[model samples]
Each structure stands twice: as C-alpha cells, then as structure tokens.
Target: MNVSITGLTKEYGKKKALDAITMQLEGNKIYGLLGRNGAGKTTLMQILAGQVMPDGGEVLIGGQKPFENQAITESICLINESENFKKGMKIGDIFKFAGYFYPNWSLETAEKLLEEFSLDKKMKVKSLSKGMESALGITVGLASRSPITIFDEPYIGLDAAARSRFYDLLLEEYEVQERTFILSTHLIDEVSRLLEEVLIVSDGKLLMQKNADELREESFIVNGPRSDVSAFTAGKNVIHRKAFGSMEQAVLYGESKSDARKAGLNVEHVPVQELMVYLTEKTKGGVSA
Candidate 1:
C-alpha cells in the first residue's frame, strides 16, 4: 500500500496547519511521525486516513483518493488519541459494529486481545477506565488488520507495563504479516528503536526524513580534550558541539569513521535521540550535534 502525498495543505479560517508538504511513503514499513506539539502530525495522519479533507493537494493510496470511498477506506484504519465511542454501547456491541465495516476483521484476534486486556464484553463504554479504553482502541488498530494502520498516540492512558505489551504485540504482528504502521508519539526514546525511517516536523513544517540507520551512521560524536577535539573536528560540518571545562565533545556529520580516526580522536555512535536533540536544539552553544 504505497501512499503518495504531494503539496498537501490544510487551512482553517486564519491558520494553515500543514503547508505544502510532500513525501513518498513506501509500504510494509514502520514510520515514526515525529514532531513537537502542534506541528501538524495529527492533521497529516487525519488527511491520509480520509477522515478530513485537505483544502488543497491530494492523498493517494494505491493510485486512488481515500476520502469517502468505501474500497480504499476499508484498507485504512486511523486509531486516534481519543476515539468517539458510544457511551450507551457495550464492548461486545462495539465489536459487532466494527466487524461489519472491516472485511478483514478477525473474531479470534479480537477475542484474544479482549482477554489479554481484561475487558468484559458487557461493560458499558462509560464504565471502562482510561487505560482500558486505550487498550480497546489499540486492539481495534491491530485486530482490524488494515493495510495501512495508524496509531496516533494509541497508548495514551496505558501504564508502562501495558504499553510494553502493546509494543511487543505490534512487532509480532508486523513480523508475521507485513503492514504499513505509522505511530505518532512524544515518547520518542521508547519507540525510536522500532522506526525504520524517521520523519521530523517542527513548527508546522517538515524538517527532515531519512533512514534511521543511515542517519545515525553518517553522524558521529567525539568526546575528549578540548584542543584535541577541536583539532579533530576541524573542517567537518559541525551540526553541534559542547565543551565542559578543558574537555569538549562535538557532534559532527559529513565525515566517515575512518576520517574521524585519521584525525586522531575518539569517536562513538551517537544515539538517535541525542543526535535529534543536538540538531533541533536552539542553544547548542555552537557545538554538540
């Protein structure tokens, strides 16, 4: 399920949430939809899921528009941070309703997940705890078996234990049957490992999109004596660097491991989160990227 979104924009009365964004998303991969608060992550996901219309531009899934079309809609599931569940409805009733709309819905998987989450079918929607409600939402996102499954902070109210379980299940399902998964969360450190590619958005605009591994590899961190580190970092495109007294650690790109070694200094693989912070931080002190 290849998705092509080009020149996408969303407009309110006086605001443009997403501005002329363009990207090509391949199928059967995990994408980390990263951004600061109010960076248009939800808007992009909503548009792609066909729940909202863009004021301009297009969203195509398998060469067809996604809005209001039953054929394409069937393959896309958008599990938002907060879902609109009927307060009067029971858990079983919700499942019955969803099963009809989703052709690939599995009764067996739904039942298994229900037990795992310790949810009772007779319980009213209003009676469930916040964590339980989140669990239910995740169950639908996974059990629906949609070609394009999106979780917009699906573990909002879940505890650390439950969230770990959800991640394990998600990876297991992904391994067995390849599906396109897009997860939007502020908990980058926890979920960063699962991302095949990272898309960073800031201030309602796309910042960068690159292979997770390649980005980490091409960039290296150097920590040692200030003079030695400065000399080693000379002529490199320094994204960021930091100094602690006489010692300095610099984060740099545009150089290979061999090149850093040839300069006679210590280099190590920088974690994705650390590299991201260095790249995005306003006060890098002109060093440590």
Candidate 2:
C-alpha cells in the first residue's frame, strides 16, 4: 500500500492550495502530516483519500489512482475531524454499514472501543456530544483495519483521558496489524513520539520531510555568550536565534554536536514542537525549514 504523489497541484480560483508537491510514503509506517492553518493539510489529505481531485499531478496507491476506484477506496479509510453521520442512524447502524464496505473490518474491536469510550450502541447520532462523536469516528478508523488508514485531526473534542486511550489503542492496533497510518494533528508534542517520519507543508509548498529520529538528532540548539554564538554559527544554517544583551540562544541545522562542543557552546536536543515553530517561521515571504 505504498503512496506516490508526483507534481501534485490544486487551486480554488485565485487561491493555490497545493503547488507541485512530490513525495513518496512507504506503507506500514506512522507519518505525521504537519502544517499551519490554511497550509493545504486538509486538501492534501482529501486528494490522497480520493475524496477530492487535484488539478494537476497524480496520486497512486499500490500503483493505481484512488479517485472513484472501488478497490482502492475500500482499502483506504480516512476519518476526518468532523464526521457527518446520518441524522437518524444509531451507533450500531453506523458500524454495520462500515463493516459492509471495509473488507478487513473487525466487529469485536468496534464493540470493545464503544465500551471503552462509554458510547452506547443504541445512541442516536444526533444525541452524541462532540467528544462522543470524535470517539465514534476514531473507533471506525481503528476497526476498519484498512491498509491505508488516515486520521485528519480526528480527536477534536476528546478529553485528555479519552485522547490517551485513543493513542494507546492506535499503537496496539498498529503493532498487531502493521498498517500504514497517517496522522494529521496540531498536537505535535503529544504525538511526536509516535511518528516514524514527518512531512511539513507551508503556503502551498512542501517544506521538509525526514525521519523523526534523524530530524531531531540533526537539529540542535546552541546557547552561550553572544560573541561566541555569533562566531560559532558562522557559515551554518541558522533556523532561529534570540539575543538578550550578552546572552544568546540560537537554533541551527547541519551543525554537529561535536562542533558545538568544540566551539565551547552548550548544545541541546530540540523538541519536535519547537523545531516546527522555528522551521516553519515566515522568512522573506517564504516558509523555511
């Protein structure tokens, strides 16, 4: 279930949502799709899940386009932030309908998740609260067991406890099923540990894509006297910097830990959230990473 996107482009009249983006994603891995608001995260996910069409380029799942294709659509399950369940449908009915469409659907998992989330099968879609609705959507995503499962900010109204449960369940299912999971969320720090790879988009362009571990390792923060920081950071890619009189702290890339130590500067690992903040900051009207 590998996914390949080549020169993908999309627009809405005068607004360009995506611009000639190209990337390949391997199956059976967890990916964190990261972007700021209006950065085309939703558009990209829609295009990948076959719910929308790209104006240019192609998206291939297992070497075939997903749009309007029964086989591919059935194999990919995308749970969005806001689910639109039938007004009159019950939780049981929704599960039953999903089981029919998904070849790998698991009734047992669905039932267990309902109990864990404290949702009743007899409950009508209209009666469930926001958190309950999100829980149901997550249940569908996990129980579907689709080869390509995508969750686009699916835990909107979930509380801390319920959200923790969802994370545990996701990892449990992934360990057993080994399916590809693409998680798009604003809670970067909370989910950073779960990501194997990361993709960042900004202003209709792909900014960066890298393995989570290597990205963190290669990204180091330097702090020391302002003069020492300035001398050490010369010729290096400076992602971010802050100065307060004689003290200074800077975020840099492509600079090794040994180099920082040799320059008599303090080096520390940058957290995923901080890294994203500095990497995505607007510079000269363009996002830099």
How do the predictions measure up, each by TM-score?
0.91, 0.96
lDDT of 2 by residue, 210-233 (tens): 899888878889999999999998
Pairs of residues at least 3 apart in sequence or in different chains that clash in candidate 1 = 240-287, 240-288, 240-289, 241-287, 241-288, 242-288, 251-289
Worst 10 residues of 1 by lDDT: 280-289
Candidate 1: tens digits of C-alpha lDDT, residues 31-126: 998877778999999888888999888889989999898898889888988755777899899889779978888778888899999998898889
Candidate 2 structure lDDT = 0.90
Rate residue 17 of model 1 by lDDT: 88
* Minimal lDDT window, size 10, model 2: 280-289
Measured with C-alpha atoms, the lDDT of residue 269 in candidate 2 is 86
Q: What is the Cα root-mean-square deviation between model 2 and the actual structure?
A: 1.6
